[model samples]
Target chain A: MSDTLRPNSSDDNQGAQPLYVPIKRRSFFMYAGATAGATALLLTGCKDDDDSSIDAKTTVDVGVGDVGVLNYAYALEQLEAAFYAEVLKGGYFTGLAPAAAERQIFADIALHEQIHADFFKTALAGNAIKALTPNFSAINFGDRTSVLTSARAFEDLGVAAYNGAGRFITDPKFLVVAGKIVSVEARHAAIIRDLITPNSFVANDVIDFSTTSATARQERSKLPAEVLAVANTFLAESSKVSAKSLV
Target chain B: MKLLSLLDRLSTADAPAAAAPRRDLLHRLGQAGARAAVAALPLAAALPAQAAPTDTTLDAILLLLKLEDMLVALYTQALASPALAGAAQAAVRPDFERMLRHQQGHAQFYRTTLLTAGLTPPAAPRFDFSGRRNNAGNPELFPNVLNDYNAFLQLAQQLEDASASIYLNQVAAFATDRQLRDVVLRTQLVEARHASHVRTLRRTATASVAVKSWPSNADVVPSPAVVVPSPAGASTPPVSIYSFEANEVQLVSATTAVPFLAVLTGATAVQFVALSEAFDEPLPTAQANALLNIFG
Candidate 1:
């Protein structure tokens, strides 16, 4: 493992080069073998922190390389899944008509996020990060406006995170996998935005719209460090995640 | 040596003009020297062995440009059509305009990248929205596509979904250029947003079209409602734009699956649909080009 993993640090410099040390093939296989099948590896890897001194306050650093990218996605998916799960449990969602479009949307999105979180956890296996507890106290889930606004932010953040992290992924297959999931997140972002304000699916805030240059119409992407800064605000101090090595 | 040769072929075959302007454009794009900048990257060094005959970065950019050009035409024509004069259609006109602008921006981005790399992008083809392939004699696979609002929305949904999938399929071709790959990924998400918006419009426009914001097995697949004429000796059969999108199994490698069964237990029918909708599948290049050919 790399020694760059740190706790509760703020490193948001995009100009800084990544401090990445690729995991050796031999060591990867060794870890895989020692953990029996790869499925148990992720569970054990996440479970190891249970008895360790690392508590909720310890900032979990998403390590470097492809593993770092996977963990980064895993962390975001976990946050999203937890948020939607909380929303489903809250008064607003429960208060909606059982057959309401908003109710179905929330239920479907909750399942999608859970599946995404589970997929990453399975794919990362030994490289998976421990589940982080979300801090959504700022979001009043009892109110429709507050819940939808926070949902938009999380979905948009998830899309930008995946878009920005693609450059850090070395494996072509991992890039493909990230490509698969980011689009769904973008879909989620569009619908959530539309639900808040109709026909506002592709807004100027989330997408660059420059009159001088047509090529700048790409979606605004956020580096891992920048994303984590906002994400940490919605996460508990102990469950806050960092990607220092990723930068 | 291989990188140099590929660059040489690109410059000679595509751009016979003076190299000074190309170098200037590259410098302005933060790539000081196209040849030197590309050669210095690790991905560029490995491209010779990894790239297939048709898998060049240039090919990926050109394909994306074509896709975007088609979308730009689709939106421009639809917005100008008299069929969209209704209150419902007028309300969503701005959404189509926004989508058009993004497609134009994306197309411009690819065109500039090719020029910066000392290549000439192919000219935009004349698009026929009726699916008659710019010929009156051809069968219309999508009748009233531009005349009927519901039909227009259906075609729009399919095109957006197909474009997103095509972008997903071509990510590897841009591996040699990280900046290009990043743009492609961002644009791919934008395409997904367009797809989701269109699906929303379709769902709201009618109760018969059951679709979600994201691709789902439970959603009704949009069809042209006409038999597509296949090219002679074509190996692959004509497939819907949404074909194979319902696949539940996701492969991380050739041998290793994602093991969704083991991970997501208690296989309820709804959960199974969620599993498919969780990950968007990539459309193969041949299938994508075939769809594009119908509207050419």
Candidate 2:
């Protein structure tokens, strides 16, 4: 997966040719919007045959607009997929989840995350960010306590991230798509939390008890900046997904 | 947060023909005969919630309030039940207690929001956990839901699952007000998590319970053998709360069902279960309201 990131050789090639390049994330959306169909055609066309060349961009920017948000999700899914894949490869926390059924659950979750990652990739054909390299140095794959705790953190973060980003979504269809995926993420979060501690699924820490009304059960949300602050600890700087303008 | 975004991808990836099939649901909403059993009050005497729900945003908020009300009632009854509270298993008590508190919190949020909006929050309806609507004359649709732990869990799972789908169905309605949309969407995931934990608890207790953390076509709950009427003697077909839940097919467009078998690469036929598990199907407002009537 890490091999998917390669330096852009096209930059050197484009230096010889006078090409129109987007200097700001906002400009990318403007250009894409002005020639919506053509922009889609270019993105799809570029990925179909010259995916390697396109993937070689040193830093893949999840551009602005709904497309940027989709790319942002695609980037996160890539990291999650890699993390679970590594977990399974490392024997699924050994004695912690030695049972065949427990391993199967992890495998199924891995597939779900991979499908999520792949869905975003296909949806954002050319605009999808490069596959992220996960730094799992902080995680102890062999220890059940360590692995499950990290899984809980990642799942809860994924849930909060989607909730915070929903307002920025413009297209109704896109909002529907996000709703579908986030529920599944919430499900994953619950199960992982339960595995860590039977009914610790909706603890006060993850949900806000202090709403305008004291009794409202508002699930806590993290802005992109806050989510990335934690998510970036595991993501290499080169592949960091910037949600600076997501709102 | 991320859950809402995942729903976006799930709609695009799973529901290929989402916008069209829902027309059938819209048609059914007109036919869902029974009105919410709130007392008739003149506008001058009280601000009735239903008087001017012409605005979708207002309508969504009201519906959400009712939904949260139903949950709070269900959990309140369950926690009060001697069967559950007196069980040998002490761990389950706090779970329901915490759950009840959360529902109360959600109900308070909606109720206060409605009051602040200058509309009177609808009076809370009486709930019968047995699905008999507290009428001694009616046969029980759900037997011993509050008394039987397993039965309580089954109902809990269904309500939570339906809660998640119902919120997803209303997301578009709250588009006009982003703050309300955020609250609804955020609360929506909390419900899904609640559903997951309940399902997990059920799974731990019963070897026969075949459910995952998320909804799936494989986890089919057999339809009850009997159909019962509400207190007002409104006899209806067995509720379809769990019927549409096991659906594997999702629409991508008005007319297109994304061929999951064809498009998803390297996945075997069995992985299709994972596909359905990966995305939850939304429940229409009429069907949701119909199901919510079961507890009233």
Candidate 3:
């Protein structure tokens, strides 16, 4: 533990005097995206060094039938909650110009995602998915713009994730419930994107004009694995998780 | 004229009040309700109404069509008001216009039925968004809307939520008419989406805004065991028409005007920035007429 062996503060320093700051920041964000994309490869099977001790081969069952859908929701909530928890951990990207506004928003989303996670946990009870860890080394938690843009991506994806998965729930009641929550997710997505750029939230890309149903104005969805990959980047190693397929 | 004096009498009430519209809404809905169940009532001849109640099936369709027309008219007028300004003004205009078009489409669809039934459809009026169809010289309809973005948005939200609730009830109560039922459901979903969009717009205009959309997880149907007895059906029923967005907007508005929002299942319900987050019930045609009377 000599001073020479100690990690140098300057090595991690970014933003100023760092010719490589922008490149590193860009690469870091893409890292989260990359991790998400490579999750199937990473998660093909568990590694022995699992620190959180959250195992898929273990006894935590997400539920049977509709419970699977709830468990799926619980899984996503865990990822969202973990992301927000980490964002607010250091009080939201220090030294950013919109730090205060962004932190408040971060705090709100953190609370919401956490609440959503808890709602499914309670609703599913024993059938709920176990907590998952998130990996954030790809995110420059220290960089505000990257974090917010990353946030916009996550929020948009969360809304889409919930919406695309709506029809999968077999129970009529559960489907309606999914509708209610998905709309809210849409609202959160819209707000976050609006903050990033005004009027960018509810675009035709997000709403389906071809839909015949009055309430069917939501965006088309991507695969669950795809959405999870985007979410995985935000998950740190400590937040590993898994849930039964609700769909 | 009495309605005018009634409104004048309440001149001392709060500047931005929704109570007047709420009461008028009841009368309007009462007419629609009566008209909807007209066929069921053997005493249709005894009751005086602008339009006679035909049969329950057509009654509901006609009422729904009327509601859609009114919604279109109200939205058009609100957006047209000289009082609205800036982005708040711009944001609502397109939505209002789209809604007007939708309402017209609904009207046309129902008009086909009315025509086949040997009845003439009601004529739609020119919209006065300024809320000034009253007081020939008073240009104060939708007063302080544009410059006062909150007022404008609150009104916008009020209309959207009202439309959402009405659509919800229509979807549940009128499951008998297959074609109409399908149309109602389709339009109802759009109404909810429209409501969601308006809510987001309202929140965005105000800096203190939070989630405008409801969670994607709340149940639309009340479970069979928990299902409240609805007038729509005669026997005890199971939860079939569940709406997931119930978490965002409650069904309590079904029982009365000024629908109250429920707390989210979580200890902390979702947050929204507004003068008041509760639903501002729609004034049915009768009720809207009542408000219009107040100005006369």
Candidate 4:
């Protein structure tokens, strides 16, 4: 989450650039059970809010291995799949109705979101995030402009979510699957941005092809805590209270 | 009869593939997953273990389909462009169509794969490259993607880039399916080559490469002076507006540097490579978008 800091509170985080805030990338990973670590994080989330609190619960007991991390991801996928299913239940609002290209893009994006949700459900099976409810109250779906703005934000966050998490999967096989999913999510992000304004897919701030020089491919992304925070804002009150870290 | 003809057309157009039995098995499994394949993906670490030669057959074919779609879309736009002169078209057309046909074969391979496995190939959509439904009178009219060369190419670059990124990452991901991963890498290299070529055209026709560079950090439409693709080393490549890692080792790659979306989505701390040399910083999706929107 520190890889790129957010100027505003994670909840109010709208459009802050990497330049303004400095997020330190968490590079250290001691060999620990991925599933256990996730459970600890989630249990931490489930416990009454406390900065310094340690209690034991029947957490998803997992061995310290790549498989543990995978199960952790599987858990998040469950959350994500369940989240989008509810968002599109009534279908996204037609923001750029006059722009058929944009509308079509939105529809495709919705399908992609649903597919992503389903994919996780299938991959995780029982371990998938319990069909938990999402909280999008902060989003003004009635206001097309506001909604698109938020969609742009969420899509990008979704892509970054994958980017920030990729390295954790030690297994080459799972890493590959992660990559496949990230691209689709990225595509969704691009299309949504393009819908808002054409040719505005990957701006200079994001792409960095240079090798010898600095600032090559440093776009931006959101942290798990931040992502979960926003996800909670959009969810019901109960979910927010129980919302734990998906990172 | 139509189905048989379609199959023949697909077969004749396919690049020389491998042994029939082996190829058939790969195709069958690939088709079974179909739409279910990429339905859901995490941010960075989605690569699963299908890379093993045993079950990776489906992943291999799907990767082919993904690559083929990207290539077809790229060529359809490039070839259709009136500005693209003679020799380039004459030279690039077959290869482009060949890419499309390859996808057709891959798609068929998946279908056959499903049949052999006693499953059904998922229904695919008739893709609209134009990015438009051609309903000019419709209230929500999208750009006639075919007519609007700019937007089409924009998408083409993204898709090609996505393909290239995935291919690059799969290099190291695929364990058992070494040969299949190699084939995908080859396609990925081809796509990268394709991206470079498209970039060159963008420079020649309209704005400089800089202008074409996507996810522009501007609220207003950028001026031609924005200048992109400056001497390759001038500016750092920004993070892709989008990302993916393929591989049940679907994104199995040759190097440790997995694909962009893979790195971004399911990326582990160990796999977190600094995106560009300039900004020692690694921005996530939210941070990146927030910055862009500020300028927007």
Highest TM-score model number: 1
10 residues in a row with least lDDT, candidate 4 chain B:
B272-281
Q: lDDT: which candidate is best? A: 1
Q: Candidate 1, which segments miss by more than 4 Å at Cα?
A: A1-57, A213-215, B1-7, B10-53, B206-208, B225-236, B265-270
Q: Give the TM-score of candidate 1.
A: 0.80
Q: Which ranges in model 3 have alpha carbons more than 4 Å from their true place?
A: A1-64, A91-101, A209-217, A222-226, A232-247, B1-150, B161-296
Superposition error at A216 for model 1 (Å): 0.8
lDDT tens readout by residue for model 2, A5-41 = 2334443332211113323323443344366474554
Best by DockQ: 1
Q: Interface RMSD (Å), each candidate?
A: 3.4, 6.6, 8.4, 14.4
Computed on alpha carbons, the lDDT of every model, listed in order, comes to 0.74, 0.67, 0.46, 0.39
Q: Which ten residues in a row have the lowest lDDT in candidate 2 chain A?
A: A14-23
Model 4 lDDT per residue over B134-182, tens place? 3334342224334445554455555555444545443342333443443
The candidates, ranked best first by TM-score, are: 1, 2, 3, 4
Under CAPRI classification, how is model 1 graded? acceptable
Please give each candidate's TM-score: 0.80, 0.75, 0.51, 0.40
Deviation in Å, model 3, residue A240 alpha carbon: 7.1
Model 4 reproduced share of reference interface contacts = 0.03
lDDT of 3: 0.46
